[model samples]
Target: MSSHPILHANKTSPFGDLTPDEFYQKHQVLHTHSFISTNNKIKLYTQTWRPIAQSQAHPPCGVVAMIHGYASESGWVFETTAVAIAKLGFLVCAIDLPGHGRSEGPRGHIPSVTPVIDNCIQFFDEVRASNRHLPAFLYGESLGGAIAMFICLRQTGKWHGLVMNGAMCGVSRNFKPVWPLEKFLPAAAMLAPNWRVVVSGNLVDRSYKEKWKRELVRRCPRTKRVFEHPPASTALELLRVCEEVGRRCREVDLPLLVLHGEDDVVCDVESAELVYELAASTDKTLKVVPGMGHQLIGEGKEILEEGFEVIFSWLKGKIKK
Candidate 1:
């Protein structure tokens, strides 16, 4: 298998309008590498933050499968979280979901939810077969969190635990119309998928929110550049998964931690509450970080560190029990 990390200039909206190389350089501390998936058709890119104590000869305390949000790559989503989790003695694998980052697929098309979930399952299988000592956990942000929840529901016995930050059980009202239209008006939108739509929201953390928004604009230019703005059909499938996951949350018997910002503009805090209340696991916890936004880890170094500490402590306690 050939392996080399690939870097592309930002050509899409949000990031495209900024200085792409500078944006990447600012957060270039993490290690990046690529592996060809067993499903040879898809190329997967992963950014890893392994514990300093870790070596090929010594297995990790656990393996964390990190998934990113919509229109964003793994690198863009969890740089700080990955490092923090790694410091807690785990191997963090932040994957670029298909159609984002270096992963191969139609640029921004997701035909349905099953394929994405299948890819995640395949990823876990690969990890389990490759590393004997490492237990696997799911860590997802935003839309990625929704995907993780679906995987946990469908493949119940596979994971050790699950951690979700700003998970979307349902899209906001502004984005809701797209859900139904996706099911009925598929042809019209797909034909003009680049159609533009305005998304407006308020910021919770004035400083971090502004900086993060600027960073997003710099790193993910494609998000805003597309004129025809219909998300992939697979994106709609995400809602179906979310509906099922919300109803079947009780089916997930593994330990779970659902974290959300109290003032999150992207995803409602109620979603986190629902997951916390519905999960069948007796060891679940819901933490609401006051004055933070959707990107908990990137909101601030102190907030990010404290959040990871909570997660690590919880994971440690779970392992002991």
Candidate 2:
């Protein structure tokens, strides 16, 4: 497998000391960014990474549409996985949902899931259209995992497989708002939909196991000092989405690879188990790695490599000529 790109990342930059152009050259992949306007006039940012050779006559082995977690964009640390997959001869694309990254919307305010889902479908469909013959897969992390499941449920057999890492099948009880605060979410959401009031867990400390990695994620050039806490409306919608996913995951019949950290506190591991059990996908596989946190990529070097190795191997086995 191509070395996990995270291996090159430092606390200062995802590219270590290399400039963005040098970083792409180091990995031998071509990367590009663009923006698309949604029907509501929201400008969603999108990125694509492909092996340089594929830019010529050679076609890619397959296509991978990726979705990043809430508060997370498609670039910076998130695109390392894209580069890793691209180096192994597949095309990978990711989109920054509205309210995050360069997209236009209130930061961390997801008033409704419908528009977010629609935006994803709009972007992913275009990338998948490039080479209809090549097998395609959906890859999402954290909240993105839930959205990916919804996409698969809606599109049914449009995708060949799905891979979710640290997926928020359900929010960890330890992470959600404490008692009375949860009870008032409906009223709070209705009255002040944009209020950044739903607060409890510390994602940086809870998500990344390594200290340096936590610092790296916190300093994300895209987010910089932006407040990442979801507003009342988004918080309420996320809870609803989790319940809806658990209630309807049985309809998800595509091949699946569910990877979650055994010790993840931000997203429940048991919910992942529940998903693995109830999913209609006959080819589903569940792996709960011990001693890891919400971000599998931030696990110590050895663990990160092994975890990603499983993903790469799975993708290669499923690819069509």
Candidate 3:
């Protein structure tokens, strides 16, 4: 636990107090939504925000496509960052993964990550097509970070850079399911893929340095508490994803910014370091903050502001905005 604690205001959005358009007007941004059809025919929820024309006389600086972590959705805390980026004269878009948030699918269950990545690629491809004249970037947190990296690898030269926040490059030893459960994952998954295992209660506790932030995350209606643990199938798939990513770290040639908490117990900092060390990209940076946990957004205001400052500065430098 971090001793340097700070209380944060309950995160609130204008969506409740005003209409969608009214909220965007008040914020000086343009907000739009689309129900994108994925390869699996899943009607995924997608949204984008761009600065109002008056906010930036120059054409938008760039376009950023965001992917949220497992059990998380783009419609909640993640939207805060999207809005901030849009207000900074960048067009930002995000999609809710099939099984999460407003997207259509089963709750808290992902049998495989392929379809999810496919969904993001489809939506992000559409966004990229519309903004072909602008530089493009990918931003992801936790599992989404790995997905973003895979996407970049699959489509070289497509992105100007990648921003990974506490990405799940590798699972931490502290959070791995117990001995028998971990060892039996493959067989168990085959037998009962959808079965929810009794693991990872500690993730939420270790993720947010602040208790209130953890509580606030738990209160999110769109993300249920059941998401705390990966379903048997998802768990097995995650291990494979990490293994494949670790093996192919040298193939990551895109400009990258990988941020992780030195003390993060969910996604090991060592994994981030490993990626940093082996990545073929010439323009790559790794920032490991001591005592910080998994959720940078849940950090103290001072730390949170500094983290975003680092991220935005890096993005601006890479995109040349």
What TM-score goes with each of the models?
A: 0.76, 0.96, 0.92
Q: What is the per-residue lDDT of model 1 for residues 184-254, given as tens digits with 9 covering 90 to 100?
A: 54563466554332333222222135465445544544333331243535444555656766787778788
Please report, as a residue range, the 10-residue window in candidate 2 with the lowest summed lDDT: 221-230
Name the candidate that leads on lDDT. Answer: 2
On lDDT, who's better, 1 or 2? 2
Superposed Cα RMSD, model 3: 3.6
Better of 1 and 2 by TM-score: 2
**Pick by lDDT: 2 or 3, better one:** 2
Q: By the TM-score metric, which is better: model 2 or model 3?
A: 2
Count of clashing residue pairs in every prediction: 20, 0, 0
lDDT order of candidates, top first: 2, 3, 1
**Model 3, range 237-316, lDDT digits (tens) per residue?**
88898998899889999889999888888888999999999999998999997767787877877777777777888878
